[model samples]
Target chain A: MTAYDPARRPRVAVLCSFNVDLVHGPLSEALAARGLPSELYFSGYGQWESDLHNSASELYRFGPQVVVVYPDLRDVVPAFGSTVPSKHEAEAAGAEAASALGQGIETFLSRAPGATVLCTGLTVPPVNALGLLEGNAGYSWRSAANAFNAHIQDLSEGQGRLFFLDIEPVIQRVGWTAWNDSRLWCIGRMRLARDAYPHLAAFWARAIRAMLTPRRKCLVLDLDNTLWGGVVGEDGLDGIQLGHSGAGLAFLEFQRAVKTLPARGVLLAVCSKNNRDDALEVFRAHPSMVLEASDFTAMEIGWDDKATGLRRIADRVGIGLDSLVFWDDSPVERALVRRALPEVLVPEVPEDPALHAEFLHGLEAFDTLTLTREDIRRSAMYREEAQRKTVRAAMAEGPPEAFYRACGIEMTVVRADDFSLPRLSQMVMKTNQFNMSTKRYSTAEIAAFMRAPDIDVHALRVSDRFGDLGIVGMAIVRRDTSPWLLDTFLLSCRALGRTIEHGFLGFLSRRATSAGAGLRALYIPTARNAPVKRFLDELGLEPVPAGGETFHVTIPSGLVAIPSWLTLTIEE
Target chain B: MSDKLLYETVARVLRVPLETIDIDSSPETIARWDSMAQVALMLEVESVFSVRLHSDSLMALNSVRKIRDALVHLGALPEAP
Candidate 1:
């Protein structure tokens, strides 16, 4: 289980209709298990306005960190005998509905500026209503849903507070009849049958979890039919279908999908069964290849088995294999890789090639909590790191310290401000492996802490002969009676193994000594935070054998001199 | 189900002690009975009883006593003492 602070529960307001959701039970159970507290407000049967207003008020009063509004499908269902609206009319109706919904959201946010709102588009109903099927209304209903979703996404992006949870793809994946059979919907009667509710609840729970969690940092992909239409070994570079025609378009779209991952800070790497030359030739020569060889941080293209290739990719990138998701077209190959590296996620590919686009979109497991400046420049950063490794490996007969000195590694520690606060909070939330406490905080909470009189928050930025590491580390200390409590101490794993942790702690010690604090108290061990635990032990913080999750260490006024290799600059 | 299993499920969902809960406890009586806790308690009851509680019934299961009545109504537990 992820470590959660019981005192700081993230309040969530769920604004949706109460008619019937088939899977509410499992979803509620899942949220409870994860320690997320949520409140639900239902609009009385078929009363959209009442539901929206009531939900808005509930959310405002609760001052929730996130408000999820699931529009009632039954209320949105057109009158039983109404004629199907033309495309223009349907679009107009959709625009009108979106405006109304947006207004309601604006009103709610005016009351609670700190809250983040998420609006889920109307899910595909299990049964096409009689009015919908008659007079080409089915397509119109879908169009209206799409229009509403687009408007919500636009509003969210504009306000920087709204998030649209696209539930359509999930519904399409399970299919309408199968979903109804599985008891995932309430349909016309506004009630779910008892047997089907748990599964329905599980679906919602999974969707919510995906939305709230931070996305994986790396995407490990397989070649052959997965990236291109055919194996490069079998078809050769010229013979492969990858550009402007039939199966080629599918491969083209897949390339486009892989390209976007890098833009979102998900480092792309290839794990395939092919000659390196052949793969390179395709990447260079293929006109349809939207993804250039430059896009990938590392490429493991060889006749070597995929499992070995995956391991090599992990080694080259210096990220855990568990953080990667592998994509492949062949089930046999996927199974082989999965069996070899069980920690790596290998999702099943849809049988139909047409569904590939939808499959790629439904991968919300890799969606990010928030985008930062570092995220925008991540690919270039990884490329630079790779270059740094090559430079170090090539240098022979030089002292390690001399080599580091020659490279000129410098760190700048800046005091927290509004501009850097979001990135700082992001590091605190996502930096799990190297984190001491594994503390996760909402942006509002972080902002409040920065404003508090007794708290000191510091942001660390690193740059070397190669490039800048952006804002990579953060430390939060609270002044207490005896010691400055280390409320949060975390650094990105990319900055680890370089003694950046030691430099950060050294700086913290200097600051504590200057402030007349005697000790640094740190919260102790979690499964993912062993690296920090080891670091603390190395720093001579005697671990008291207490059974719970707290650790204390008294730092002498004079500890160790700040390492000369780390040239540190402080900014107030 | 045994009272022990039932109370354990509730405790696990609430992240509290099994001993702290009793048959008379409900949303109104339990200090932790906010909307979120109410939802969690209902989910716990459903899993422990292995029976689905309708959304309406879940709304009504505010107290431990009310939840016990719901369990009996759903044939998940015998009539309460």
Candidate 2:
């Protein structure tokens, strides 16, 4: 996914209006010129209803790693018509339209839960009505377009399935007249002409890539010669050069940068080639050591191969090797780790220690789309995982099931509230490996759903003898007259292989049935969510394709027994 | 400029064979005309010609002709494109 290879095209699904993009010509050409392989699903121009369903199907079939929806002309007709309703009425209409569209999107996403969907927020059309009515139409159109974009943003947040690409800043920078000449917009006579706009295309492509790819979770650091000017073992812990003066200041700035990552949700770990006792003493005793023992989730301080040390750190923290970025001054150690774990990213350390700060900042390999609560608590989670391993090892004398049961695992399912909103939104945004709808949401939008009467959302918290996994799973439901639509269902990657999702859904279905809901229609069959696509099928729920990736199931009112392995309780 | 200097700059930028570059060579003329190579080329040109190119100029300098024109504008080359 690096910008190096042209042939390594990411499968992209373009879901937007099928119209003449007169102004956005350059954008279109730029995408084409890059040789970016894409499947364009045009919602017929001015035909919102048909386009919505068609686009959904296209999204499912294409199963693109990234979904880019251009809302250039989709909202214009509804915005400009004389019969357009007031804000409240328009909101109600938008909600209805969104729900219907969501069903199709849900189906598509269920089939390709790992794909990152990018929705280009509505663009202002170049139709100025100055001659028509003193430019009142232009003003009205801009106002309406603003409202439409807001709704799209809300929908993106609520469904957790869309990334809002706001082109306003880029459009403003280019300006209207300049933008017109720049081929960012189509003007008179040309109508739907498209010109090649490489700059804007590059911006959009970079943004999309940043959103889809996972950033490095853990930074494995070497302390001696790398973090400071000298080896702690040879120079003595107190004698190391690290502080606000000379070569020490450079290390200090690097420490500051590494420390900031944890706040930004990047966990720090240490894998130093030094005696365990000496390294620990240096970390504890050094006055200039801004990064302490507590900063790292795990540390491997020994003369073991750097590759072996990184493996131990990764295993202890319960993360894949690929998710780690190793930093070492020794090229030999770096090369060894690179050979053993080619997936692990090892950026080159500059010869001059003073240039470390600039080198670290210049590395774009660890960039992510958005930071969520999971990121903030990632270090803590890894710490808990390490503790869990020790506890499990102690209890390993008996059968695994006995040890797990003895851990006093208790599950709690509660309707999502402000307290659990961050975690729930995080599960939607970042949980890729075990997600049913690779949907992403914002804190504000998830809060809005909690306030909505028609939507039912639940968050699950699992606690064991070791520690509490605070709000690890979430499910959002939209109630229609006849059936309850499972809008979104996702669990953290750590909670996988536990049958927690199945248990959670069983509990949810029972609750829904008790609430007088008869049918449970799940929009499933995403590429990355196959684990749950046949979930209802295994439950004896007959699945019939309702066009696209949606499935309708009629649930019997009988009390279905949840998996015995799961010990469940409900929280109000 | 001698072929040696041009080849050195091209090889450093492309990280490819010095033998692959010629006076008439362009991004399209080379096998590594990917996004990364484009960026590397821009960086190399900046270093070799000692000239800062604007975003538009960077976009325009895909071909050797365009690069020659840019170098002339930056006074790194003498009246030739």
Q: Which candidate tops lDDT?
A: 1
What is the lDDT of every predicted structure here?
A: 0.70, 0.66
Candidate 1 deviant stretches above 4 angstroms: A1-43, A46-117, A121-162, A166-206, A212-218, A229-231, A246-249, A284-288, A311-323, A338-359, A362-380, A405-410, A422-456, A474-493, A496-571, B1-81
Cα lDDT tens digits, model 2, A1-572, are: 22323455566555555332322434455456434443344333444334335645444555567666654433434443444344455445444444555555555556666665666665554644322342243333444455556666776676566667777776665655544332111211122212123445655665664664566788899988877878877988778889999999989888877877788777888998888898889777878888888889988888888888988988877889988999999989888888999989999889788888778765656666566766777777777776767777897787676655666667898988877876677678777655655656787888888899988888989977666777888888888556677777788767765567667877877878878875465555666776665555567767677677666565566634576767899876
DockQ of each: 0.03, 0.05
True contacts kept of each: 0.00, 0.00
Q: Candidate 1: deviation at residue A429, Å?
A: 7.6
Worst 10 residues of 1 chain A by lDDT: A181-190
Q: Candidate 2: deviation at residue A103, Å? A: 20
Q: How do all models score by TM-score?
A: 0.56, 0.49
Best by TM-score: 1
lDDT per residue for candidate 1 within A285-342, as digits (tens), equals 8877888887888898878888888888888777888878888888999899889999
Stretches of candidate 2 above 4 Å error?
Answer: A1-205, A388-460, A463-467, A472-570, B1-81
True contacts kept of 2: 0.00
